[model samples]
Target: MVADTGKTLHADTLKPVNLPEPIAVDEDSAGGPRVVTLGRKLPVAVIDDVWRIDDEWWRARALSRMYYAVILVNGRRLTIFKDLVDGKWYHQTY
Candidate 1:
């Protein structure tokens, strides 16, 4: 489905499921992992759910992290992730 600009219309969280190349996130959250800004901080939505993932056991140094798919009050969607190893979270704007 082509959108207004003629680009293929893809649903939010439509990225091919995969983790970023073992990168570090910013400040950790005490309230637990949660998403705030998305879409490059301009966000179409605010994350509502946080999902955790840590599979780099093979790479002992890689820290496992949490991910979130925020359902903004506007009904938009955004993805966020946090590192459990260090307790930091990063936002993935849709």
Candidate 2:
């Protein structure tokens, strides 16, 4: 669900959205995802939080990702992630 603060709150029950259009990103010197483009460019104003998930490593396929809760230059907050397994970006909403 989207909060009053304009941040989308994500949950596992939320359906995964595979964007038809790829989002363009700007990275920091450290090569971390720092800016993102949806329909328009959104520079990351602040990273409210970050976390990593590494699961199913024991299996032949692994599920790994780095998630970030970020505020954009336009004052929108979103939850985005980089898939560690394939290095793709995704945005989520609930």
Query: lDDT winner among the candidates?
Result: 2
Q: TM-score winner among the candidates?
A: 2
Q: Write the per-residue lDDT of candidate 2 for residues 19-66, one digit (tens) a residue.
A: 423456777897566789988777899989989999999999898988
What is candidate 1's lDDT per residue for 11-79, written digit by digit as tens? 873777555433232233555423244333332244466666668688868758667665645576646
For candidate 1, the 10 contiguous residues with the lowest summed lDDT are: 19-28
Instruction: Give the runs in model 1 whose Cα sits over 4 Å from its true position.
Output: 1-30, 33-50
- Global lDDT of model 1: 0.53
* Backbone clashes under 3 angstroms, per model: 7, 1
Alpha-carbon local distance difference test for all models: 0.53, 0.79
Clashing pairs in 2: 1-94
Question: What TM-score does model 1 achieve against the real structure?
Answer: 0.44
